[model samples]
Target: MARITMKFGGTSVGSPEAIAQVADIVKHTVDERHEVLVVCSAMSGVTNLLTEGALTAAAGNPTRYQAIATHLREKHSNAIRQLLPSDVERISIRDEVDSLIDEFETLCYGIYVLREASHRVMDKVTSLGERMAMPIISAALRHNGVSSTTISASYLIVTDDQFQNAGVLFDDTERRIRRELVPVLAQRIVPVVTGFLGATRDGVITTLGRGGSDYSAAILGAYVDSDEVWIWTDVDGVMTTDPRVAPDAQVLPVLSYGEVAEMAYFGAKVLHPKTVQPLVDRNIPIRVKNTFNPSFDGTLLTHEEHVTPSTVKAVTAIRDVSMITVAGRGMVGVPGIAARTFAAVAKQNANVLMISQSSSEQSICFIVPEEKSASVVESVQDELAHEYGRQDIQRTWADDDVEIVTVVGAGMRATPGVAARVFGALKEASVNVLAIAHGASDYSLSIVVRAADTERAVQSIHRLVVLNGISPNVHAPEPIKNAVS
Candidate 1:
């Protein structure tokens, strides 16, 4: 039997009924005699609650955190009552969970006094979700007649000092995982590990950022050299596009490491973008399966991506984005303008998503999350204060009304006219393309369009390129009378 690392997402363990399903799945897997390490996400929405508590307390509101503490108590205690049958077990676990929440209140009090939440403190606050999740999952596993124990991932994975988004030290992390978790496996006890969390060498706890539970599973699976990392989530698998957008969107049975990475980066659900690199480096496989529909084969991610004749695998979108552009004749052939412009955005800690530059070197345009657009514009202006004073950069503006749609496939690299087909579809739909970026990797083609046109643009692209079912309501359109360059 192969060693398997199974990760259950938040929705899979969101409540008593969900935890029961997870327990049943684990018992069946262990009954088959495979060495198993289970990774668990915080029960759905707990991390958000923890984050809200921290921010509200920093805004000087104790009443909010106190009420939040009580609400948490109700949610978990109600869960304990339903999951653990024996009275003694229920009392024991309830006390432990309450103590964890009490510590949450204490941490919030500290933040309230200081009126500031540092990244370190925010990580600490957010990590409580996973901390509270592990032991309860351990209890639920035992309730299902499986031998299981909770292990903190921080003890197993070591990373650099970056608090909110720490980078793992792979060599050291590998050594630690081997030293600590192997013996537990030898004992035939399933180790249910916390996801979305890690620590520095100094033992200060850190988080791997949002959706990091997937990354945690990837790291552990690679270090332990498991046969595959199974991500159990809500959906059947990765779809042609989000089902809400095009109800006809079908599940893709297979994808390549490169293809899935692009989809995740461009906002597909069920996998994190950072989760792909570690598995790709080791040639390990990732399988996305539905927790509700356990029998479906789901999507398999490996090195060899499938390419249809259409040369388009999927169309996906990232919304709530803005484009910032800097333009001037004086910027032509300029040396450091681009570098200085982005260095300023970096100082603001803004994430730049896509970038385009004219061949004339006269303008630089990029995308950022819409919420960060105002501050990013301010910072870039400040960075170019001298250029503004002298008029070298004649115009700088942010348009916070855009969304990015990306078409993904490995087949695109060898196929000609793919770009023409994509633009041709969008033109037929009358969706204006604000900016365009073709990824250096050749796996994706991204374009920015007005936010209002997002769903229509995605639908239009999905209809033209995807091979299976023809989307309804897709039609040939009148030719464009005028075009903008």
Candidate 2:
């Protein structure tokens, strides 16, 4: 029997019907004699509501948080009543749900008292979503006659104390996971664990950043040495591009870990680089499936490359980002201009999504989220003020209206003329290239263009992936519109 870790996303377990489907899938897997471990995200929209409730409380609206708590109470209680038919079971589950909601109300009240929402407080508030979900899902599985138990990831995942974005302490985390999960699986019981949260050495709750449930799954799958990981989400699979931008965009049936890693790193939201890093290291395969469409094998990501003639697999745009440039004649041959510039941005807690420097070393350019652009510029300006006086740094500025359109494919490493085709497409579309960056791995080509040109630019590069690659996609994936539920 294959040991599999199935991770259900928020929408997959969002409603009573959704949780019922999740229970059926687990039962099927267990009936097939496979040792299954299920990881689940919070019900859809619950985390967002929790976040809003916290912010509203901090804004001095205790009533809004109370309203949020009530909404949550109704939501979870309704799911329990619908999923568990026995009156005794339903009442017992509602009490558990109410207790969790009471804890949420208390924490939000604490935030109202403080009048400020700190990262630590935010993590705690957001974590309750998953904590509330596990018990309900486990109860559903039991109702289906599948032996199952609920587990909080805080007991299984060991991480650092970085409140909102804790990094996993892999060695300790692996030890805890096997110690906790193995015995349950040995007893032929499925262990339903909470996703997206962990605890520090001191036992303080911490969350892996937003959309970290996938990362949590990858880590657990790797640590337990599972045969495969199935990421069950709402989408059919990884699409060629955001179909909203390109009408012809199709779901990719197969992708290499390297290709998806580049896509995630460059800005495709379906998966993030950290989510796949562990799977890549362990050479484990991941199947991105639709909980709604279990019959279709959404997308199989493996270590071995797909032998296709496509030079570029996918085109993505990191939208709503701004670019900053530091340039001066005196900055040429300056040893610390690049180093010092980044250090200053890092001090502001700004993430540099892309970096490109002039060959002459006279200028350095990087991309940061638009929201953090102003603060980054102000911080860099202050830190490099002395250089400005010396005329070594004549200008340090940011371009607010830019987007990074990146085309990724491992095939580009061996294929010649791919770069020419990319720029040629942009030129053909009459889109101006503001700047460009290509990694040493030769997996992706990124170009900066005006925000107004984002749609046109994304369409252009995506057309290239189609002309170069889609013809040979032997394992066809379903269209997003008709994909399962």
Candidate 3:
């Protein structure tokens, strides 16, 4: 029997009906004799509501979140009533929900009284979603005849005190999980663990940033040394590209670790960007499966190499980004210009996404999030104030009218002319390339195009690379002449 850690995203456990279906899936896994460890995200839209409520409270209106709290109370109670089989279990879960709702209310009131939401306070506020989700899921599983227990990740995964974006302390976390969770799994009682939120060594609640639930599952899966980790989400699997951009986009049945990383970095939303980090060293495969349609075989992501038919697998785009260009004649032979420019960006805590430098070393351009462009430009200008005064650098500005389109495939490394094919497709589609950056790893080819041309660029590239299966050119030497002789 294999040990599998199955993680259900928000949509998988969005309601009573969805929870019932999730229970059925869990029961089937148990029937297959696999040791199951479950991780769950909050119901759909719960965390967002929670965050909004906290902000409302911080804005000096505690009464607004009261309605939200009441709505959540009713929502959870309705799910318990509809899905739970036992009357006693229903009553018990209702009481649990009541206590959780009360706690949520108390926290919001505190936020209102304080009139400020610190990072730590907001982390605590947002974590209530997953905290409420696990217990309800556990109760639903029990009603369906599966013995289950709700576990908090805070007790299992220890992290540093980074507040909203805490980093997991793996050594202590692994030891604690083995000490705590292995025994629970040994008894065949499925442990339904909360996702997203963990605690520091000092026992303060901290979140793992956005998409932390998927990161939670990966962290737990690595510690438990599961053979495979299955992430159940709404989509079928990782597609060639967004179907909205390319209507005929198809799901990729298999992907390598490198390919998925590139896809995720380039805006593929199927998996969390950090989901592969923990599993990479352990060699555990992460399967992206759809909860609604379980019969279909979803994509399997692994470190193992597979025979690939296409030179490029997918074209993805990140929209609403700004490209910052810093140019001047003074930058032509400057030694520390690049370093100093990036240093300023780092000082502002802004992330530099993609960077390109002219071959003549006259100027440099890079991409940052649209919202961060102002701060990035400010930092660069300040760092180069002397250069500006000396007329060494011309100007530094951001263009918010651009988006990034990336072509990702490991096969591209070995295939010649892939770049030409990509450029040719974009040219044929009449998409103007603004800035291009290709890394040394050959993992991806990233180009900046007008935001208006994003969908067209993506569609054209997908058609040429994925649908048409552009192959590398191979030349058979003059050996055929000898055979003819």
Candidate 4:
């Protein structure tokens, strides 16, 4: 009987039927005498619809945005009507949902007149999804006789003014959340809060960027000092690899914080990288569970957890990446050349995926998505020519045909020969490793290969590192050479 925070994603609570499924899970946890905090994403397609409405309005047509908001409002009102029998309760939920939609209309009107999308305005516009969702979920829980109250996460999770991907001010957020939420927990009233949204100190809406819901749950879990945070998604658990590409990808029973962080960074979709930091700092464990499979024990993540011998936890990959290399003689002794290069790329709104620099400082390499490669190259060249007046800076882009494959496991850190085994498997499949990057942590290794060969590379590596549980063979040490050379 411990306090826990459980967050469900969009697909998990997309409809009345889905909300009912989540209510059932919450009821069970509450029945077990554990204090449960439920967080929910907007229903499926709701956010996308809202975004489309914003885009349409920005194109100088307000009717579509209005129509979409009205339709979405009616959808939630209908769900509440169907799920809640009490007239008073139904009216309350309906009013709350209407107010949120009204706010959306106001935002749409701004977009229509201004014809531009600002980050702060977009944050407010997008937050309506969670705003509409929390009430319906709370009403469903109540209809099922569970004591639950819907709380807007914006009021709880405080962040800076950076509208999207805002960095959380932990001390301030923790103080406020703990002060406000402790009383509710004491009364055993389940607070069903919205995830993926937060507010600044001045009451401006902000978001946690992509996959913010997971971060929301982790932040709340850390602030409340809860024993565990459960992220209930559509998947069974974190798999050894993305099961879609690699059919034999298996679920990892348990993973260390380092292992999970690496996978999340390299392309595992189960948890967000930002979510893990709060939990890791506080030593709070996270459990990844399937909303549909309530009885299954999901994968557990903790700090420094031991790994089983000869086991690979999961394989993950991200495709359609382009590697960009900048090499020139002028770069050899340059001090701020790297900074200028990255600044130019950032100015183009291009994301720098992975960066590698030569020891001699003569070259620097980075990866970006294929779509941005040309623009990135132009931006880098222009910046170099403008800043240094050097035409010698050479730019080359490679393999818009590449994917980054990563294999993650805690055991890999303590177990020798994991890297050798990974490369050996790729060798067996005749997959060429374009570039390799591994950190000192040794929990994971990443390699870039041609996009066409991604599936084969994943399958081959999965077989060698995961199924066979065999490390690659190592060569004997070479004899020491004389200093005469």
lDDT of each: 0.85, 0.86, 0.86, 0.81
- The candidate scoring highest on TM-score is 3
Ranking under lDDT, best-scoring first?
A: 2, 3, 1, 4
Candidate 4 stretches with Cα past 4 Å from truth are: 328-340, 343-349, 357-363, 386-395, 411-414, 470-485
Pairs that collide in candidate 2 are none
Query: Which structure is stronger by lDDT: 1 or 4?
Result: 1
Q: Between which residue pairs do clashes occur in model 3?
A: 330-392
Model 2, span 1-485: residue lDDT tens: 77788999999999999999999888877887788889999999999999999999999998999999999998998899899998997888788878988999999999999999999999999999999999999999999999989888999889998899999999999899889988888788988999999999888899999568999999888887878888998888898888888988878888888888888877786778789888889888888988887777788888876645667878988888999998899998777877788889999999898899889988889999999999999888888999999999899899999998988776676788888888888887899998988768767888999999988988987786454566553674332222223
Which candidate would rank higher by lDDT, 1 or 2? 2
Position 408, candidate 1: lDDT? 91
Query: In candidate 1, how many Å is residue 219 off?
Result: 1.2
TM-score computed on alpha carbons, candidate 2? 0.94
In model 4, state the lDDT of residue 133.
92
Ten consecutive residues with minimal summed lDDT in candidate 3?
476-485
lDDT of 4 by residue, 1-485 (tens): 68888899998998777888898888877777778888889998899988888888899997999899879977887788778889998998899889889888989999989998788888888889998999889889988878988778888888999997887888888888898787797788889998999999988889989879888899888888888888888887788787888888766667788888888878878676777888899898888878887666767787855554454667788876788888877678868888988998898898876777778887887788778888888888877884445645655455587888888777566777778888888999999987777657567777888888888999998887686752333111211111001
In candidate 3, stretches whose alpha carbon ends up further than 4 angstroms from where it belongs are: 470-485
lDDT of 1 by residue, 1-485 (tens): 66788999999989988888888877877777777889999899998899899999999998988888898889888888889998988888889889989989999999999999999998888888888888888898898999998899989889888889999988889999988887888787999999999999998889998568999999998888877788989898889899899898887877888888889888887576788778888898788877887766778888876666667879999988889999988888778999999999998889999999999998999999888899999999999988888888988899988889999988686789888888988988999998989857779999999999999998988887674433343321211111000
Question: How do all models score by TM-score?
Answer: 0.92, 0.94, 0.95, 0.90
- Between 3 and 4, whose lDDT is larger? 3
